[model samples]
Target chain A: MRSLTAPRRDPAPSRLSYRLQRLALTPMVRVAVRRGLPLLALLLVLAVLLGDADRRAVLTDRIADLRMQIQQRDEFMVHEIRIDGASDLVAAEIGRALALDLPVSSFDLDLEALYDGVARLDAVSRTDLRVRPGGVLEVRVVQRVPAAIWRGPTGLHLLDADGARVALLPRRADRPELPLLAGEGAERAVPEALRILDAARPIAGRIRGLTRMGERRWDVVLDNGQRILLPRADPVPALERVVALDAARDLLDRDVAAVDMRNPARPTLRLGAATALRLRNIKLTELGVD
Target chain B: MTDLYQSQRAMRAMRRAAMQRGVIAILDVGTSKIACLVLRFDGPDAFRPSEGVGPMAGQSAFRVIGAATTRSRGVRFGEVSAMQETERAIRTVVQAAQKAAQLRVDHVIACVAGGDPRSYGLAGQVELEQDHVSEQDVARVLAACDMPPIGEGREVLHAQPVNFALDHRSGLNDPRGQAGQMLACDMHLLTVDGTTLANLIHCVKRCDLELAGLASSAYVSGISSLVEDEQELGAACIDIGGGATGVSIFMKKHMIYADSVRLGGDHVTSDISKGLQVPLARAEWLKTRHGGVVATGMDDREMIELGGESGDWERDRRSASRAELIGIMRPRVEEILEEVRARLDAAGFDALRSQQIVLTGGTSQIPGLDGLAPRILGQQVRIGRPLRVSGLPEKATGAAFASAVGLCLFAANPQDEWWDFEIPMDRYPARSLRRAVKWFKDNW
Candidate 1:
């Protein structure tokens, strides 16, 4: 049912008017689209690249700062050192011993290793090394006290409590007040016997050198060279009985070359080569009987 | 063909036959080096295990026939990496030692460092056939311990029965002739990677030596380094080698656990090289000459010259301060200690009654290490040297050579190995699954 006839239209506008409209709108739209997109994309790329470069710069700067800080810290720490309880060690000698030729300010000293090296000296028993907050080095040393002086073929060496050879005492006008040990195996035997003697210190002063014969028996020599032959069995009782006899009869003062305590019950005394005194069943209580 | 039981019997005979021989060589395949020691056990009186830590009765008795060491090759973290290189190194050290001893040997006992070794504490019970227990019964009770599924590619390195618990009584060191209806055993099974074992055995065979026995390097090191009391109670040995550091825990004179850390002295040297911008060889030399963990004030001004080869006047004349050297060395040492602390924590070192920690090995020689180690590793730290052995060179007695000297003592008096006695594998109890699960839960 569509209408077959079309309606009439007004006359077309002039070419001048059409050209004016096109001229007014085309360049504006083109400029808006073209300028906006490229500018946005360029801005985004530039931002991303700048961000990456900034991050790299920040990381590099941080690492450089850390390196500087470490170097500064090391330099700052190198100046603080304190030495404690080093009276016995000469400063020059210690420096020489540690092989330190650099100036004090330039030397990064390892106090503990230095302490260990110092402790390696026979005279040093214990040592402690510590660093204070300011990088000051502090060292403390405890010198070993010689328990006895062992006279060997090599030289006169100082012995510690455990019978370890400590050092050779310098021969001078003033020597350490320690007991002297002599004989072939006296150095080995004295330490062991001294441990036992230390347990019995009340009478320890009366004895001097202890000589072991055949590795089983021991001969205790008095300070005045009186030999006391100790029995193999029950030596403690024999020692105690001798102490009692000496206390009661002053037998140590007798002109005797040797006293045999082999039999705890029967004590024998050799005053001289020909004169021998034999006392049988000399019990601790028998001191009053004599 | 021998059945399983007959094969076990024949294995026992073979063990006895190996023991009767006079000389046995022990090779300690450590990450740092391969050491071979040939020992001659002069009958029963020559060596006796101590009752407790005191002066050992005899000192001048044991004879060291010969010893030698070579740089370990093809070993990474204690496990054999390249079999051929390891074999060659072993052959070189063993041949040199044999020549020194002027004797040819066949039997060899060796110790390895790595294999992801795991330990389990197992208890087993058996009713006595008689009223009183016998040595046979003791052996039977030990054999009754169910062998847990050791996993594929793994073999038992050490399966030692540590303690025995008789019926209504416990801590019975020896249960023979004791009256008990039930005997329970506390056994420790140490398992290592089977591939590692095969490689070690192959290397020994290629060197033309018979396998007398094998021990864990950490176990033997603990045996030689720890005092008797420490071993009887409990202790740990940390052996810091050039390539790796080994850790072992001992209780009741037996190794309860062992482990290794891949970092060691080599890491420290590398850190120095990178920090100082020096060559590795120069860094090592500097580390040995001037390295210290704790820096002192005097170190800042101490200048060390860097030898230059390019003839650049400015670079050749340049010097770095001592404090700078310490700065490079401290952090790496601290990291090593921290790693060791973490390992000890994992091993439950704090739970031990006598928690003695002994430090040995080449890296332990660092300056101020003893001081810094105790602070990081907790209390009870000591620097350990090998127990003074007869005829050992003075240079070889330091902490660096603990494993070498320990191998000597181990070869002389070998503890019972896993294959020494018969193990009834067929009668394994089913409850071992639950035990293994429990161990996994506790350890992992």
Candidate 2:
């Protein structure tokens, strides 16, 4: 075992033989390499081509998406302005209120802020603006109708059906003949007064003006200059009864200055300057109710 | 001291283990009402506890099995004033709710409306042992946060890791398993009065229930009233109750600040009673029946009979017009709104992305409140009603139930509370407690 572990001497090759062996292996190396070189080259070319094609597809898709986005943005920029139910609101004034010189569909448009700006207008009751397909913008405006004219510390103003101060009506001769209301905060009384007017539409023409005294009591001045004091409990019944009495005796023709109907049970009439007439226990049935 | 710490540790372990079981109860011991809700979790599908996402999904999944409310007793300004009476009230509500659910619950998560809650935002950073950070790394960074001393007897109500910064890129929702050498965490810790929390826990324990978790009532109320957009963008919720008005601010779906005004709907009633020389009951009736902030023309003549057995004929049948009633109610409502507005202003809520003010609770139901609220609040104002909950009676779904419904949502899918973290009792930071204690001490 000791002898087997000993090192053995090997013979060295000559320089010429070593050179020849190197030369002989070079051709074998070329033969082995040349046999698979085309296959390796082809694999490299295929990988390069596949990578370039994949990158090109991704770039093309991204370009298409960008173009689509640009088109959408362009369409959104063209805002169409459509007006509806503008009885008093002029198109130019509405446009000014909107404060948008560009088309309604402009991408820079802030619809919420624009709506809020329009709502700030005193004459506009409800304003709705929406964008339609194909960049068309439809704006619907509802002008507050002047239900009555209120005279207060703020001067003359138009009241909507709810008695809310709509706007300060411009002083003009051709303005609609609206009933005038007087007293402090009389503008707030417009809403309740409109409720009464709605119930008495048949006799609305008879009312000349409605005056609210500190939001406590109301006096209706008839077209005939007859002042009718309305009851706080139920003004509708009292108004109906007054209409009946006017029809029954043609009371409008009488020399009455004012009628006190604050109490539905008893109505007192003050003659022009001399006499007073009192009527008591006037029931709804006695007023010729069918 | 050792016994207390051992018990607290046991309680924490139990809560963590019970998280997967699903059903839990939240008790809100408020000054005006003691409300209880039983929430049953359907499964994990309802909510997954991931970071920087919307609310835990469990709310829509859980069904409201039982709910009961009783007028609060022995509570003032949202703290337990009388132990026995409060204990009785708590027992009554819990027992009723437990019976209704047909299951005897042993644990309860509660919210107290008091404790002078204060918020502090803390930031900390830790170097990761490995190149890639894992969940453990996040936890280690949170633990490494130099927690400010909360003080003796005060407990941490909420300790949530709100934002994370990884290798200088902040706002990363989840940094776990990400390759980074350094991790930073921005944590929000909400601390409350120790004695208030202890009293609440003792009250629940007296009723033979375990205290699983606790939240601030103002925080939960905001959760129920605020929409997802409002919470994400930023908004404030004003909950007007009988004895106190609660204020809470929400950003990124978490409560950043909370406070309460020691005045509320009850004060308005008192004003009416004193102004009109009417009984408390009658004043409340008038306030509920015809109260409006904006008076109209018809209010002057619209009369209401003062009903009672007064000896004098004039006193018995006396009548005050609606306008007179409005005159008394409007000023009080305005005062409450102004106080809330001041609180919001002090909180710098105007700087939020969206400054929405939501008015909720019983007093918010008053007519014409929305029209008048904007004048005092000076921002977008809207009346809020609790979103409808499944299996809840229609009668229980109103602005008044905001806190109760919110508690149910909280119990079903609780966000990370202080108890959820691995806090060492012995190693608790004194400095943090001192800062939190300063708030309560100064406030009280």
Candidate 3:
């Protein structure tokens, strides 16, 4: 111990007891040790999702920008649209109906929506769309052929035999070649009306058009506004009867106002107003009931 | 006899080993508590003794790495009364310190305040072979001291040359490389009860630790608590511990006289416990918090709860005035201080020119001990705490750790003693039994 206190002899005692020092290491390690990168990515995504409004908007804009970049690639731009099987005027009308801007990215356009839009035109029957090489967008359109003109409370419409819209007409005289069909269900009865018109071919000039009555049978209106009421069941055979009468007795050419063929067993005719008045005065009331 | 010599040699070797390792443990075994401290020494480059700077620098070479204290078990007056219980208590402290340090230590230097240590001062002289005194001449002179009869079951604990004289000149700190015809040395030898030392050694071994060194608590307490100037001149350190009061006198930076008193703070606690009809633990708390040697008119107004924790509401709520507590605690504290004064007086401490006394240890925490100690001990009494060591936990830097801190200093630079030097075996006394060589004594 004297060596210890020999005052200036050994200064080593200045470096003293340190055996018990410990590091606060466990807490730090608990914070650092985790399954590394994926957890960080998950945290980043959650941060973005829960962030302020501006952050969400920024993400949405970035997604849209990325989509545009993909869609605007040189090979994906649409340069032109072509319509097949249509008259020039109808084709121009189809183009106007489509209302698509050329050079728009093909990916930017919804082809199904374009097809539906162009098919809204009365002349178009079918539409096919494909993007060919060199950024050309080809549109194939089938135009509807008018089978008849339909005159209803809404006006006159030229219709195909299958009841599809061919075009809208200003006046029935404009589509004189088309068999005139009228009434509420006239459009749907276009095919039957055309068959009935064939049975009335002998009285074709006197025939004005066909009117659908109560959506069940057709009323054949001849010149001078006479009517032929065809039976609901096999109206074509009833129309053939009208044709047979017209051929055997020139029935459609008489001053008859209307012919009732609603019942196949019995057919009747109504005279003109003056004639009906004279006949009533002559005591023909048993033959005509008002 | 050879086995005993082997043991002494082993102790010397252990000290060297501790120095080499640059880290060691200091254990204070007292009747009230056992404290262990792990100390780290500075490398050779950082040790500069000139500055007199203690190891309190934040990054100083020596620092406390770990410290643990446990209530002593099966111990009385700093002596182990029950071996197994003492071993268990030692294990508790050692393991706690090891855990805190996160390292295991195999060597320990322990301090005991008991064992009835007795000190002897003797002189020896030898003619130098050459005109100059060498380390050989110093060793021969140390070997020339006449050993005293220390009675049976006692062994020399410290054999150190306190001072050296060469021919007509004296007061030589080192006689080596000096021209001299004759060399003389003053050596101090301390002896403790052999059985107690043996039990301490056995207990440490049972704890799986090697007893590298042992010191009288009184000696280390003086070393750590006495100011350097007081040590250089003359002073006495009185360590009033839980079970024993350790007293040592230092002159010229070496302990020349030492003694112990068996009654200590525990006796005062017991007095309070009995006087108030309270449990020992509660009485201890009262004594520490409210104990005073001098009471004033205001003391009666200060009250302390003498409550028992025994689940009896009436007893638990009992209160005692501070004056009454002082009445119970004063006499006991006075008695311990008086015993220390007697020991100091017996050692002829009053003859010293610089007669300062320092009081230290766990029980020295009494509020007015410095004021009370001087009334009993001396006019220049002061409360002493261990010098701050670097990185020492604030909790471990109290008067309680005086011996432990002193041990750290000693481990860093222990003075060379007779055993540290090589003496020729042929110079051994012919009849070495009943007594060791002339330089040492073994009373087995």
| Candidate whose lDDT is highest | 3
List the per-model TM-score of the A chain.
0.57, 0.61, 0.70
lDDT of 3 by residue, B299-355 (tens): 999877777667679988999899998887788888888887787788888898988
How would you encode candidate 1's per-residue C-alpha lDDT over A232-281 as one tens digit per residue? 66666666667777789988777788889877678888775444434333
Q: Which docking class does model 2 fall in?
A: incorrect
**Per-residue alpha-carbon lDDT of model 3 for A28-114, expressed as tens digits?**
433444444568888998987868898888989999999989989888888887667779999889788778878898878888888
Candidate 1 deviant stretches above 4 angstroms: A1-290, B1-19, B44-61, B305-319, B422-444
Query: For model 2, how does the per-residue alpha-carbon lDDT over A21-132 read when each residue is reduced to its tens digit?
Result: 3343345555657776787888998788767877879878999998767755756665567778675445567778776665533556788998898778777889899877
- Global local distance difference test of model 1: 0.71
Residue B158's lDDT within candidate 2 is 70
**Candidate 3's C-alpha lDDT?**
0.79
Residue-level lDDT tens digits of model 2 in B1-444: 334444545655555555556556778787777888777767646544333233343465677678888778888877898987888787777766766775556677787777777677788899988999775677678877787877777667777777889898887767878888899988887777889878878878877677876677888889888988898888899998877788998888777778777777878889889988888878888898888888999999999886755556788788889899889889988988888888888888888878899999888999999999988886599999876667676667878888888877776666764335444322446758755665586589
Measured against the true structure, the TM-scores of the candidates, in listed sequence, are 0.53, 0.53, 0.58
TM-score of chain B of 2: 0.85
**Local distance difference test values of all predictions, in order:** 0.71, 0.75, 0.79
